[model samples]
Target: MSETIRRHPEAATLMSYAAGTLCEPLAAVVTAHLSMCEDCRHEVEDLELIGAGLLGSLAPAVGPAIRIPKRPLECEALTDAPVVERRRPDHLPAPIAQVYGLGFDTIPWKRLGPGVWHHRLELSAGVEGDLRLLKIGPGREMPDHGHGGSELTLVLDGAYADETGEYRRGDLQDADEDVEHRPVADKIVGCVCLIASERPARFKSIVGKLLQPWTGM
Candidate 1:
C-alpha cells in the first residue's frame, strides 16, 4: 500500500496535469511532487485513465489535422556541457537533475538575500509561470507575501512551517490567491524546495518589493 501523504495537490490541479494543460513550470513541480508521493501518483494515474476514456469518446474531425514538426532536443544552453551520463544526487529528483549538467551541490546559485539563495530553471521561451529552486538557511523566514495567481511548492529536503502547517521532505504545498503566509525554514538544517509560481510574489514589505525585480521573485 502507498503511504498516505500529508499534503496533496487538489483534484482539479491533478486533472489539469494529467490532461497536459498545465503550464510548463507548474507541470515540472507537479511532476516532482508525484515522484515523492505515491498517493498523489495514484491519483494522477486514475485521472489520466479517466481522461483517456473521455478522449476516446470524442468525435473525430472530418478535415485533415494539422501537424507540427518536432524539434531536436537542445538543452546545451542550460549547462556548460552537452548531455552525458552523470549520477544525480539522491536528494534531487530526476525531473530536476536532468535539466542541468551539474549536481545539486554544484548548481550555480544566486544569492537573493541574507541566508537565502535561488537557482532559476529555464523552460521554453514564452512559457507561462516560472520554476526555481530555493535554499533557505536555518531559522530564516521567507518574505511575507500573497500569491498573484497560484503557487506550488514541493519540499525536496528539510522542512518549513507556515500558517497552513509544517511541511517536511516530499510534502507539497498549493497556495492560491486566497492564501497568504510567510514560511520559516526549520531552525536546525534549514530547507530546500522546488517552487512554481504563476506570477511574481506580492511581498508586503517595501524592502521586499524593492528587491523583487532584482531577485526575480
Candidate 2:
C-alpha cells in the first residue's frame, strides 16, 4: 500500500505531528494516512526519535522527589493468560474505524449537495477545526475553492484528480491557503475520502458559497 501511494503530507506537517504540535483534526487525518502508508510511518518515527533526543538533552526540572507505586507480580504464568483477538473493517483505516465505531455500510451519510454526501466527525470539546468523511458520486466535480488555512485529505477508497495530480487509495493531499482547484471523482468507482481542514473552505462560485453555511465545508 505504501509503494502505490504517490502523494503524502508535506515534511513540515509530518514534523509537526511528530513534535505533537499539529491540531487534533489535522492530526487525525495524518494518523489515518499513516495507517496505510508505511513510508510515511517510517519518516514520522525518525522525526519522533530526533525530537526525543533533543528533549533528552534538556536539564531536568528541580523538584521534590516523589515515590512511585509498583504493580503486584502476577501469579499466573504468561502462557496461561487468555489470548484475545480483535478485528476491524478492512475498508476503513484503523484510526477512522476506532473513531467511527461502526462499519462503512452503516455510516449515516448526509446529503451535502448533488452527488455529494458527507459525515462530520465530532472533535473533543473546544477543539478548533473540521473533520469529515466525504462521498462523491462518479464523475462529479467539486466546486473550485481555496483553503482559508490548511486542509489535509486522505483517500480511503476510490480516486480523485485535480490540477495537482490524481490521488488513489492511501494517497494524502496536503493543501494550504495558496492552493485553489476543483477535484473530480473517478467515473466508475467514485471516491470516499477523509478530510480535515483548519478553517472553512473559500468557494469561488455563488452557489457553492450559498451551500457552504449549511454544508460547513
Candidate 3:
C-alpha cells in the first residue's frame, strides 16, 4: 500500500502532527493516511523521536512541586491483564471507523448535488474546523474551488484527479488557501475521501457558493 501511495501530507503537516500541534480534524486525516502508508508511518515515528530528543535537551522549567496520589494495591493486579483491542471495519481507517462507528455501505449519505454526497463528522464543542466523508459518483467532477484555509484529504477508496495529479487509495492530498482545482472522480470506481479543512471552501461557481451553506463543505 505504501508503494502505491504517491501522494502524502506535506513535511510541515507531518511535523505538526508529530509535535501534537494539529487540531483534531486535521490530525484525524493524517492518522488515517498513516494507517495505510508504511512510509508515512515510519516518517512520523522518526519525527516523534526527533521531537522527543529536542524536548529532552531543553532546560526544565521551574514550577511548583506536584503531589502524587496513592492508589489501592488491587490496581496493580490489572498490570498483567491482556489488552482488549477494539475491532474496526476493514475498509475504513481506524480513526475514521472509531468516529463513524458504521460500515461503509451503511453510511447515511446526504446529497450535496447531483452526484456528490457527504456525511459530516462531529467535532468537540467549540472546535473550529470541518471534517467529512465525501462520496462521488463515477465520472463526476466537483465544482472549481479554492480553500479558505488549509485542507487535508485522504483517499479511503477509489481515486480522484485534479490539476495537481491523481490520488488513489492510501494517498493524501494537502491543499492550502492558494490551491484551486476541480477534482473528478474515477470513471469506474468513483471516489470516497476523508476531508478536513480549517475553514469553509471558497467556490468559484455561483451555484457552488449558493449551495455551500447547505452542503457545509
Candidate 4:
C-alpha cells in the first residue's frame, strides 16, 4: 500500500484542487487519482461546495450576474506532450498513456542525461509556483543536492526509496527545506513523479557544480 509513503500531501494543493483553484497539470493528476480515490475527489468537491456556499452567502445586493468571457480563458494548454505507454497497476490503476490527454498532449521524450527523462509543463490557469516532471530510470539516483523551496512528489509508476522504504504508484511525498534525502530509483523499473517545487535545486556535490549547467537545469 502507498499508505506508508513519506511526507504529506500539500494541504494547500489539496484544498486548491478541491476549490478548483489549480492549473491543468496538477489538476489532471488529481483528477486521475480522484477517478480511483473517491475520498480525495469528494474532499475536493466538498471544498468547492464550501467556496460556492461562502460566495452565495455574501451580500446579494453587491453586484450583477457576471458573464464569463470565453475568448479570454485564463488557462493555456500544456506544452510537454507525453507519448510513452506508461502503466500504473496500483491503486485505481490507470493507463497513463491514454489519460495524459486529460492533461498533456504527446511530445517527443527528451533524454536528460543517462536514463533520465525530463518534460517541462508550461503553467496555465490557477497554477502557482514552478512545477515539472522528472522521470528516473532503474538504479539511478539524482546528484545529491539540497532544496531551495518546498518540493512535492506524486509517484505515478514504479518505485524509489530514500532513507525511507520503497514508494509505489499513488505515493505522495512533500520534501521541505529541512529534509534532504538522496532518493534512488529502485533497480526494478524506473520511477516517474510529478514534482512541484518553489525554487531551483542547489547543488551540494562537487560533481554537481561541475555539471551545474546540466544539473541545475
Summing lDDT over every window of 10 consecutive residues in candidate 1, give the lowest-scoring window: 62-71
What TM-score would each prediction reach against the true structure?
A: 0.84, 0.84, 0.83, 0.64
Question: Residue 24 of model 1: what lDDT?
Answer: 72
lDDT of each: 0.76, 0.80, 0.79, 0.57
Give me the runs in candidate 1 sitting further than 4 Å from their true place. Answer: 1-4, 57-88
By how many angstroms RMSD does model 3 differ from the true structure? 8.2
* Model 3 lDDT per residue over 19-100, tens place: 7788778887888888778888778877777777788854332211110111233324545654434343456775455444
Cα lDDT tens digits, model 2, 95-177, are 56655454566568998889999999887767788999999999998899999999998988899999999999989999999
Residue-by-residue lDDT tens digits, candidate 1, 1-217: 2434588877778877877777777777888777667777667767767776787844432211111111133544555565444353656766566554446676788899899999988767666677889999999998889988889998877899999999988888989888999999999999999999988789998878988989878
Residue pairs of candidate 3 with colliding backbone atoms: none
In model 4, the clashing pairs are 18-44, 81-105, 81-106, 81-107
Query: In order, how many clashes per candidate?
Result: 0, 0, 0, 4
| Sequence-dependent TM-score of model 1 | 0.84
Cα error of candidate 3 at position 23, Å = 1.8
Q: Give the winner by lDDT: 1 or 4.
A: 1
